[model samples]
Target: MSEKPISKGKRSVVITGASRGIGRALAHLHAAHGFDVLAVARNFKDFPHHPNITCLPLDLTWSDAIPKIIGCLNATARPFERLINNAGIQVELDLTRDVGDETPALIDREIALNLTLPIHLSHAMVPLMARPGGTIVNVTSLTSRQPKSSAPVYSATKAGLASFTSALRHQLAPLGIRVVEAVPPLVDTDMTLGRGSGKLSAEAMAQAIYDGIAAQRRIIAPGLSRPVLLLNRLLPELVAKILAKS
Candidate 1:
């Protein structure tokens, strides 16, 4: 039998960190897929005035502004059936910066963006999205599966997100909302600029997220992320050691 097609109708999605990189790519891709989107970023200047998209610029690390932004969107008209937590920044590249020096800031920032923001935002949108056929895709990292010594904090943040996604899926599955983890390998984006030995194209990662949403796949790992997940499952210690050396 042929599979049922994805029910498309102005996908009605909310994607964070939409100014550039994977987040920006996702916004464009979703629009191309006929989604009416609310794209949030650090500032509106980085976003374009697309007919299908509404740009909401605010630093999510603050955490206090999320409800207000959601309220604004709701006041205008709720056009979000899916919430893509795709916004993130990398502070670990400056790894040698040291703990007492700036590690606290890095740790705090990662938790805010990678963990707290998404969790709070998800909670806010649950009633709106957890009804039926609703979806959520969290943009995670290959480092979650393969711990890189160079980016210790980034890996921790991704790992936390991975765990959160699974737990969220379990909690919201019965409610009909699909919480998915879009695990991406290294991508050629500003965040990964000048970093990551080999890079997966942003388009590739975007397609993976789209496919995951279409299929309601709980975990979508593209390119090296897939292999990394496998190794993490089969030989975690070996993978950890290998990653440390890389």
Candidate 2:
């Protein structure tokens, strides 16, 4: 479903996983900053309303998801200036565990949602993006640099996305479309609850992402992720060990 946008003159941003957490914060932040926001999520029944925010309730893993999104944008006839691929899922499981009954489905869902959907969505959205200065922001994780033992699949997906973001950046340069990797630290979102300490708020991360885009930063490693990435470079083993325990 799509909500009618309140205004048309403002620059537009399309954000996935926008019903809650960082995605929700991003939707509100961009709308507040005078951008018409297309907020995509599976459900928006609980999402806060905003005149500039148009809600698109969609299951990203569906085969027809990309087409539906394209249709929604086509209805607008306006190119989006930014696209943020932030929808993801993390299903923690031990690969060595004897839970075949659930392992395969869980792994497949995690991989599909965390990696495949974003890749496909980004490719599909490129044509709809504003040329000469469009930005595509892929939200990554610190776990990409140092895998979390309990969330192996999630970590792997983030790492794969990071690599894709870098390669896409070079490929899109001629088109004047910038691809960015936003590596946020452990955030105080539902996904990270009961998992980490000193978590950054979703609002803070949302602001940082906006600032990074404005500054044309290809890699935005905000909060603790900045120092952790530096430390990881100097002491990879140490960083890995620490993350393995998280």
Candidate 3:
């Protein structure tokens, strides 16, 4: 599908998972700031309708379609200043439970969306973003610091993405493209549902993300993520115990 024509001289940003929650907030924030936004997600029935925002509804779990998606992006006349890898899914499956016929498929989809899709998108987009001041933002989770007991696969995928972001930052530094890791604590999104207490609102988290990017912060850990990351470093055993009980 062709991207909506953007006005001349507007900076562009690509944000995945832009249909709701933090992603939606980010899309609105950037659009409000006069950035041409390419918002990608599976559903766009409720996506924002703005002159600066172009909604592309596509399921990110289809890994093979990534190249075509990137090609469509590259064909656009607008210059891409930022790529926010925000599309993710969490499957809370107990490893101890009996294996169901659908278990493997669910696990595969989780890994594809959370880890593989970002990697593929970044791999393709980095070359296009070789210009100075370009940035890649990966939205990981606090679960990366301490794996959750109920969501083992989801936690593992986040942890893997965290490692990839770290290595990518150093690799892309010489190219003048910054790789940023946004490790958010439990956000009050549909993904979390009824799980977290005192979770940061999506708008608040989106504002923090914008601020962090503007400041060029390599790691943006908002709310409880700040202290939790510190505790993970300083008191590994205590952090593990706490996570186990959580």
Q: List CA RMSD, all candidates.
A: 5.8, 1.5, 1.7
| lDDT winner | 2
Global lDDT scores for all candidate models: 0.78, 0.88, 0.87
Backbone clash count for every predicted candidate, in the order shown: 1, 0, 0
Candidate 3 Cα lDDT to native: 0.87
Better of 1 and 2 by TM-score: 2
Off by over 4 Å in 1: 1-9, 93-102
| Model 3 lDDT, residue 22, Cα | 91
What does candidate 1's lDDT look like per residue over 52-71, in tens digits? Answer: 77777678888566886677
Name the lDDT value of residue 25 in candidate 3. 93
User: At residue 68, what lDDT does model 3 achieve?
Assistant: 60
Cα displacement (Å) at residue 134, model 2? 0.1
Q: Write the per-residue lDDT of candidate 3 for residues 100-177, one digit (tens) a residue.
A: 999999999999999999999998887667378899999999888888888899999999999999999999898889
**Residue pairs of candidate 3 with colliding backbone atoms:** none
Error of 3 at 191 (Å): 0.8
Q: Where in model 3 is the C-alpha error above 4 Å?
A: 1-3
